[model samples]
Target: MEPVLPLVLPLRLRIRLAQGLWLVSWLLALASGLTLLCSGHLLVQLWHLGTFLAPSCPFSALPKVALAAGTLALGTGLVGAGASRASLDAARYPPWRAVLGPLLVAGTAGGGGLLVLALGLALGLPGSLAAGLEEGLGAALAHYKDTEVPGHCHAKRLMDELQLRHHCCGRHGYKDWFGVQWVSSRYLDPSDQDVVDQIQSNVEGLYLTDGVPFSCCNPHSPRPCLQSRLSDPHAHPLFDPRQPNLNLWAQGCHGVLLGHLQGLASMLGSMLAVTFPLQALVLVGLRYLQTALEAVGGVIDEEGETQGYLFPGGLKDMLRTAWLQGGAAHRPAPEEVPQEEAPPKEGLPEA
Candidate 1:
């Protein structure tokens, strides 16, 4: 058995193994490229899906179509490039020629495996996948607001509205002091009040109406109570101040966008996990094999030179050709080799 193990493989067996390895390598390269392409396409689709679903946003189908087309083109390019590179490399290096068949086969199989993994993860882990994205966006928004000055008028108005809409004022003629007719007329006669009285009344009214109690000022309150008759729900919906409709809408939108983002992230993460590390390992192995083959070729070339049968058509010739072309300007013109005078044949021992 030991002696038999050292026997050379039949030509048929050797050819089959070579074919298998080539197929595996080509498949791996193609699969890696296709996975990358699909990931990109999915990302674009996610964006277009988000925009399309947005309530107030205008939807254009062009982006979605473009994404699909781009992905298709990318996949085609990847497969083509992988096949071409494998073929070219195999032609250039004899050892790689053996492994190419197996590599192509294995690559195809691995890529198919990764595609299955990506699909499974996309189906299984969407929301959990997207949570970090939401948190990150929230943090970014907080940071941006902290660094930037309030720029828009609407922003200021929103801030003011948020602060002022829900508080209670004192019962006294708070309006008259501030020269507001509504509060002054409700409690005090403007005609009867002295200048000082009017001023006090208006200031009191403004303070009572504007000052929000800690309990009533809770921004999260769906409903807030104020210490005034005007705070009743029927009279002033603004008494609560918080916009439930807007909050609900915002929350719903956030949830939906988050789900989409999570779906995408999970799909991408799964693809990377399955495809990248495996592909990298395959590539490393291929490189090592390539180096080993080159070493063997070097030994072969040396042996061939000793035997006066060195093959001219090889990497050495190709490299020499390339070097000559690149250094054409620097290279000296070939000098003619002049034949030296032949020595006279000696007929006898030198005298």
Candidate 2:
């Protein structure tokens, strides 16, 4: 192996940078992991809002961004610390000379990924998600009963679940259902004439009606709650929520769920943003550490390369590197002169 080159940075400064990288990397990973873990389930549930939408969810890639950020941050920090050690004692970390090169390249790629992630958060993720949910929600209502009779609508099943789980009615209100006996929802798509005909055929003569489905009814509402009339809400004058059909939820599911998803998107964006600067700093430090190690004769593998040490540099390559990197890189550190005087040459004797 070639002799180690003198370090570019002072020993104490390099140590400080390594310590900082390690500390920040751990903290960033912990924070991102916890935040995502707590909210991931809910985010996944809301992603269903984009299920029926054409082209699917625009924010599908959003959730994984946090995970990637955390992973990269942790890896970069670990590599930085290792590079620092290699700079001090290259022989101990024999493989690092090869490892550090690839890691630095990966860090560069990771930085680009972070930039794209930031753009996704800022430019269009929340809005696209909301739009998809809105369209999907409406489609669910229109196609509620995907059958001849009112019993077997896959879309309706999801809608009912949404209503019950969120304490909501139709996309807007209980009135959105229009009538209990009829499945001809106002949300019916005019383009699908067959679906419209099927829904109308389900409604028959002499059918009694309730204002909303069971899912929209409050748990405290009387058993088999039917919101045709009977209950006098004005009797109390000031009831909670104060809507005409007091027994049934009057609000829409769209606004409530959309708001929640928006909140989640904001949080994801914010936390990701917080990590951005720290990750950037770590990459910078990591690059510096890589430089120091390289200066100390570390053999780094370039991007897509594995056998840097196996192949020696050609005469042309060394000259190219020397010229591009200021001959032997920058000025040496002011620590101490590493060179020793060569032994004096013996005089040519009796020529």
Candidate 3:
């Protein structure tokens, strides 16, 4: 099969292609940076709730947030440098910059894409995640209380807030609070209970009656439920065997939180789908421009006519002709010239 011929694009067209590729890549990088920054802020707002659900979560800290922002900034800087070089000083533009810019963009996109894909995949397996959360979250909460003793007051406050806002209870249900050390331990504020009572009374006071906070009760109730019947007008209790239907909520926050995470994953996936192809297109267009530049350079000679190495056979044919001429110039003539008669007579007389 014949090899496909390289395109010989006009210089003006080549310049336009280069500029377009740069524009697309630059916009993609800039947009990705902004997306990451906004996502990080959102994560921070939701972080308090997320940690209550999964204490060991990696995104609980700010480094991962910083990483997302940093990668985007790096890619944008490299892309801008490459674009300026390509436009203002084409001859000085390093080929390495062409490669580096795409690599940075691809790396950022690929990493974030894979992270989102993994989150989506994990959440998609709701059965496994649900099973794990049932025992894992309960254990995490219990451990936090045991270590903190008396209670992890800050965590408890946050947990209560989360439960109220999301309409959830303990890990599995309101009953799970019974296992938490903070509620079960009798030595809450062992030293000078009367002295420390004023500041910590509201939180500690819940243990006076039941382990669960009023937040565990349904928010729709008219009054605070913990006071009596958790303010449920019908006075439905959580663990009453006969009143299962009147419970605050059967579903756990695990599912609700995971669903929100799934939305974030979808957002990242969409961004990846859009940016990855644009980055690839920029790389391919730059490569085409490079090839076209080389082709044009080879075709135009000193006399400005299409010359050596312009076509597949051009260089070889020129070399072959040169070889044949060199060989003929060194070869002996087919016919020999006769010697002069005087030279013959002089040779005889000497003999």
Candidate 4:
């Protein structure tokens, strides 16, 4: 078989191709970043929850890394687009060139980070991530406290956030709360004696809470179900072995949370597939633009017409010959002022 020849686009077509492509790429990049950020807010809560683990966790860091990577890429893309447009200013070329080094560095780092994330997702996420969460969540539950308990409030807040946001209960199910130390260790505050008294009275055995957290209650459940000894009406003040707990969340948080992450990973994979190609094309177009900038004489098209400013003709003789050596435009020469001719008149001898 014969070797395939490269598709060489005409100079005019190449220039035209770069022309509005930046905008398209930038929009796509922005969408990708925004999607990552959408998950970032919830990740903050998980980050707090991870602190309960002796060595923290993998899932905890994933979204944070995504946030940082997306931010860096988005920022770099915005700057690059601005620079591309500013290239036409002709006055800003030096600054643009100067900034190019940092942009390249940042873009490379962000791109590399995104590639790594995509690769990680492609390899699959179930086993390690789920295992980490499964183990770390147990540790987190041991320290659970719905109210203030120095250095642990974040955990409680996160637990509640998780249950409420996911509309589920506990790590594995509402019953998981039975094994946890639900009451805060902090000294009872007089400011809210009723809640404190309720907490103290509910304690059973060494340390116990039979009912799930208030966050465990379904939003549509009656107001009475919001408090404990959280009776299911039929089994007030006592857990009934025979009856179903209608007030409590029937689903567990672990699966819902894990499934959410899987969705994000899938989304990330799709976005990466689309984004990388657009970025590559944008970079290729920029390479051509780079050549045009260095040449400073406009590219010659297949029809023999110049596509940009050129010397001795195009755009004020290449903008007043300022870019003669690919540099800034030169200033116009000053006008000559005329002097009085009295001395010449006094010595008016014929030449």
Candidate 5:
């Protein structure tokens, strides 16, 4: 197969390419950073929503969207910058002489910056801010509790009704009301069978005593009914029989887990966004510096073509010039010419 000739680009095209790359790099870096920042905010909002909304609703979905968008933007920017550096190197130098410093600086600075920012926003700032806001709101609401007499009255009445329904008279333990058991005994502690048996017996006995009708008993008795025997309401459970406290517990757990996951995703997204752009900027700066150094040092070839300044010849020249002009006494010897005595000896061979 015939080898394809390397296409020579016009000077305008080359300049445009450089400028375009620079512009894209800057824009992408900026965009990635901003997207990450926004993603962080969204993450915070999602967590805040989780406090009020059900886990399956906006609380669960928004973070996934933010994470997906932010990650895509960040990753694209980083990949573009890397690819641009590689292309630039390929165009400017021989394959073996291409420099990697610019690429390294660009990738590292941008990637690293984003990483740190994401972590800070996700783990530190958002969580702290949310907590602070929640605490402040709680305090404000607490202050208004006394002034809101009607609402307070309603709340108190509701509490009283709940207490009556649950058989929570403060004197009767939670175990008696909820059919739960507290086993402090050491032998029962280790044995699951014993624990279960104790809990069952306690719960059944408490439920039976509480559920059954009883007349007035002496308050001083150890088994005195703590609650005043008020008029009984509807005789069954307040909550639905099928769905119990288990549903509430499960919902709470789901919300907590979803919030944490969203926070993590947001943090990762932010990190990607901030880190790569900063790195690209650094690389561009380094490349600019290298170019400037080459120009100042007059490291161009005879054809007035400037190669990289830190090339082998340039470094050697710099060292040699520096040493010679650096006040060293040692001097280089001059070249010698052969005398005419050798030609005369050749002619004398005939003699």
Candidate 6:
């Protein structure tokens, strides 16, 4: 086997690696933070829709937004400190006094804390998969249909927007509202004789053939499907000649909304995939540079202080100093060292 290489790399290589890792980690962190904020915004919008029909307990995305902001702030501060430490001239400032130890400590605390929170969220997500979205929505819709007063205009607007944007019908389909008390209830479908017969029996107003909400119709459809109209008067033109029925979207808003949320989650997972490893690389590079710094010695020229050694006990010494300097919320008094009585001096009696 060839002779073993030194534990540390050359100064030039270390410097270059340190700079590259620091820059990459900082950029990745910044990008991740922005992505997380966007994801949180998507979640909050969905929550607004979910609580639209049923406003029992409001879902607020404040916590998610706050967490993202906190992470961004901490990452930015730590990266800055690490970069400052790395840039310090080895000849004038030792690694410890260059503040590398404190910076590393802060970095480790921030990174480890984020990792723990992520792990906790991942573990807890499975417990609230749907959180009664389907059941609660069905009940709320049923109650709304029965009540003629039009209780939740906000929710109705949200649903209309959702339907228009996603090209979907009701919660499941246009048929989900077939049993509603509205006059347009009869305009579900004429092809299904059973449904038609049911509507005819339950019809409170004039008998008209069927269609979906105006929002569900394609914008350029020959005949406008109006929200006020019980059914589109020109049904043949509403449908694309290729497919059956009115060419309206048959899927539900619930699934599409949930999918938006799931995409947010996936975005978060991808960010973590990039960030976790990038952070580890940054930490390792900083550590290597710090070690290299140790060997160079005597950063500051002092008569009494040890050359190249600002901290004598490594991290322990740094922590002690930080605590003494009021870094902690409550600083503890230093421990007292017991002293032994001295032996009798020449011609002098001992105490």
RMSD to truth, every model:
17.0, 15.9, 14.9, 15.1, 18.7, 11.1
Q: How many clashing residue pairs, candidate 5?
A: 15
Q: Pick the candidate with the highest lDDT.
A: 2
What is candidate 4's lDDT per residue for 50-82, written digit by digit as tens? 543335445555555566556655665676577
**Candidate 3 residue lDDT tens string, 209-260:** 2346566677676544452333244554443434444436555666666666
- lDDT per residue as tens, model 5, 62-158: 3444455456445545554554454454344333123445444544555555445444444444334334333432332222223335433333233
User: Which of candidates 1 and 2 reaches a greater TM-score?
Assistant: 2
CA lDDT of 22 in candidate 6?
Answer: 61
At residue 280, give the lDDT of candidate 5.
52
lDDT of 2 by residue, 62-142 (tens): 666655655565566556555555545546656766676677778768754864565465457777866776677676666
In angstroms, how far off is 148's CA in candidate 4? 8.8
Clashing pairs in 6: 92-299, 297-308, 298-307, 298-308
The window of 10 residues in a row where model 2 has the poorest summed lDDT is 302-311
Give the lowest summed-lDDT range of ten residues in model 6: 300-309
* Candidate 4: Cα lDDT at 41: 52
lDDT of 2 at 84: 54
- Candidate 2 error regions (>4 Å): 1-8, 35-43, 47-57, 64-70, 81-91, 147-152, 179-210, 221-224, 229-245, 296-351
Cα displacement (angstroms), candidate 1, residue 43, comes to 6.1
Clashing pairs in 2: 97-299
**lDDT of each candidate versus the true structure:** 0.39, 0.59, 0.51, 0.58, 0.41, 0.53
Error of 4 at 97 (Å): 6.1
User: Once model 4 is optimally superposed onto the true structure by TM-score, how far is the C-alpha of residue 242 displaced, in angstroms?
Assistant: 4.8
